[model samples]
Target chain A: MSLSISLAINGQPLDVALDDPRVTLLDLLRERLFLTGTKKGCDRGQCGACTVLVDGRRINSCLALAASLDRAEITTIEGLAEGETLHPVQAAFIAHDGFQCGYCTPGQIMSAVGLILEGHAGDDPERVRELMSGNICRCAAYKGITEAVLEAQKAIADKSGAEQNRRDAA
Target chain B: MNRFDYVRPASVAEAVAAGSEPGSAFLGAGTNLLDLMKVGVARPGRVIDVTRLPGLDRIEWLPDGGVRIGAMVRNSDLAYDERFSRSFPAVAEALLSGASAQLRNAATVGGNLMQHTRCAYFHDLASACNRRVPGSGCDALEGENRLHAVLGWSEHCIATHPSDFCVPLVALDAVVEVEGPHGAREIAIDRLHALPGATPEQETALAPGELIVALRLPADAAAFSRNARYLKLRERTSYAFAVVSAAAMLEVEGGTILRARVALGGVAAKPWRAPEAEAALEGAAPTAQAFAKAAGLALAEAQPSGDNAFKIELARRIVARALTLASEGTPAAMPALPASPFSTKIGANHVA
Candidate 1:
């Protein structure tokens, strides 16, 4: 049966008509919305190539049903930037060479951002590597990925700290 | 994937009513069900989305000092909850050791318990699997039986239940709360899963349209809060299923064990409890020899296939090590996997 859902994708309101209830969130994003930044690697939860934020939590979009997410706030790879400026995770990945083929880069950055927001990306590189095992980099760019996650975490922390300091001074 | 009608119910009664329809399934995280549906392993005509049901997602503390964890509680939230982690560290450790961060964030407690096996034959449509298709033969019994069961397996099926949460729940003596057409009822964790006997199709003990509501830990289980350990032996360091996992809980008083609970996973159709081992440990000193003897009794009836004979020995060692770690109040270190004859290291020259 076809259903209608209204949700926010990357901070933009979207009203999607489901042709089939089995349509996955990944397909809805890539095919329906034309947001092709999210890659479908395994189409299974095994590989986190379809990672996206639903209500600020990272989940595999390939396994999630688009119709089930009626009013959820979704953030895709395209939503990470502010006009011309890239998110810290995206910038850190470029600086640290966190990608080789760049297919899994979007998922990796989204997962790293979720990790930092979830309070998992601490100062320990080993912890970061373990937590990021969901997002597989077939190119084996794990060394750079781990470094970039830690760097992005520090950058985010510093920016928040400076903001808090400015607020206090004001 | 086949076409299916989806309904997001607002309340538990509506969810249960929707689930009563024939060829309907309750959808939780869709981490496993959606994948199986994509591969044609499961074909449901309708899916009831219970994710939005109110009051089923919160973790509450009972007046008896036990925890009542809602079925919709995400695996990551349960693992990271301060009260749950402090009260049941072994459960948190087991949850963290099973899946990746993304999966844990999506999977729920009820969905984890209702997850099917990771048996390759069961997932492959081309292969003959009795569990997937009744009257069909099980190919895993004779072909690539390394990941098959070493206990509680019959000629019809040899699939192992792939659940890390079940091992610790069995050890903690948890109770499963369910609501069905009849009424609300409670089932012991050990009685929740059935052995793969003649009818491998019947996996759980729940009746049709019985939805799992929550899991309740016993109040008396607080005695094991400090002296429990979960040890999972996997082929890789992380994000892999267990080869042999053990959850051990010991209640000691002055160097003597007052009570003991042990359960094994990845080697049986369900979480296999070691009752003889627990009985033998009571009133005995928590020593290496005592643990070894208890572990031996636990695997006395293990019947293994040709390729999975090694799991019997592996489970014995894991049970002993887990008991020792629990008695000493120390966390178990990740165990190194046994070197397979076909294993080879990737050389730098091979990388492009």
Candidate 2:
């Protein structure tokens, strides 16, 4: 039996048909939709290489079924940047050299964005390291990753703080 | 994953009707179930999606000063909830300690409770495992079992339940509300899992087609909020399962313990509640010596099923450490590394 699901992937509304019920969100993105930015590492939930934002929360897309996510808003690595500008977390990762070989970079950046949005990534590097433990980097780039998350967190905070001030001045 | 007919039920009754079908399995966030299916350990003919059930996603504060948490509540959402964390700090800590942030964000409370053991033999399709296929000889009995159960194990199976969240819930005497084809019923959190006596295949007390609706934390469970802590020992600093874990909660009056609750994880087929150890703590002072005695009593019946004799001593020490931390009181805020032994502070103040 074929199933139909509608979802907003990378802010673009898309309707898809699934002839098989076993298609995971990761496979749906990479194979069917051809949005290959979300990498699949272990295919199991052990690796967070397929991390994506579902309804503004970071989740392992490899573990989630596509049919179960009807009408859900999914943000992948391709959705992080605005036009030519990169998201602060993406910029910070490059500035801090947060990855080597770069296979885990997309998941790391997405997870960091989710962490900051959740307000769990405080100014403390230890908290960032602990919260980002879900995303593994085999290159041993944790030191850089922690630094990048802290910088990006502060950047987002400052930007939001300025926006609040603008509203106050108005 | 094998091909299956997917059904998304709009209501609880519809979900129950669909779930009661033969060879049908309920699918939550699929963090654990999908993984097992990929490994060929689970092959359901029909996949019933219950994530859309309306009332099963709320956290309600009962008028009786207790809390009713829906089974569909995500692990991270429940742990990070300000009011819930303030009241049940140990449970929050245990939730944060189990899986990674991504997995926790997707995993639901009911899914966490229904997660299977992490025994390597059970997941290896080539290995013989009674829990996977009944009447098959247990391969873990003579395999790599350095982390198997030591407290409750028969020759048939030696696997330990791998949930960190259940440890504190069992200590708090939480109640599980379930609905099935028969009707609605409640099971004490401690009795939800079964010991591997002769039927290792029967992991939980849940009957066929039964779905966990919600979990209730009784009014009295909050009484230990001032003195509750969950401590876990892991193979790594983070993102690892517990080698041994303990949850200790005490009600101290005038420097003497009025009531005590202690439970252990990663040591048995289910979350092990040490009633004898808790009884030993009553009317006694909250001292390290007293904690040591209680810890010894907690592991008195523990025996190594394989080359894991060191787990017994380790479990005992962790129990005493958890008790000491509980007596010191919960931290004003959760630590950076929640529930890890390295996050221990000598003098943590109680949450106000």
Interface CA root-mean-square deviation for model 2 = 3.7
lDDT string for model 2 (B205-290, tens) is 99888999999999888899899999999988788888999999999999999999999999999999999999999999999999
- By DockQ, who's the top model here? 2
Residues forming the 10-long window of minimal summed lDDT in candidate 1 chain A: A120-129
| Residue-level lDDT tens digits of model 1 in B1-352 | 8888898988888888889989999999899999999999999998999988888898999999999999999999998897787788778878888788999999999999999999999999999999999889999988998977988899999999999989989988999999988889999999999998999999999987899999999887777877887888887667888898898889999989999999999988899999999999999999999999999998999988649889999999989988987887733321111111111121111122
Off by over 4 Å in 1: B330-352
Cα lDDT for residue B195, candidate 1: 93
Which ranges in model 2 have alpha carbons more than 4 Å from their true place?
B345-352
lDDT (tens digit, per residue) of candidate 1 on A75-154: 99999999999999999999999999999989999999999999854576656876898999999999999899999999
Taking all chains together, each candidate's TM-score versus the true structure is: 0.95, 0.98
Residue B107 error for model 1, in Å?
0.4
Which pairs of residues collide in candidate 2?
none
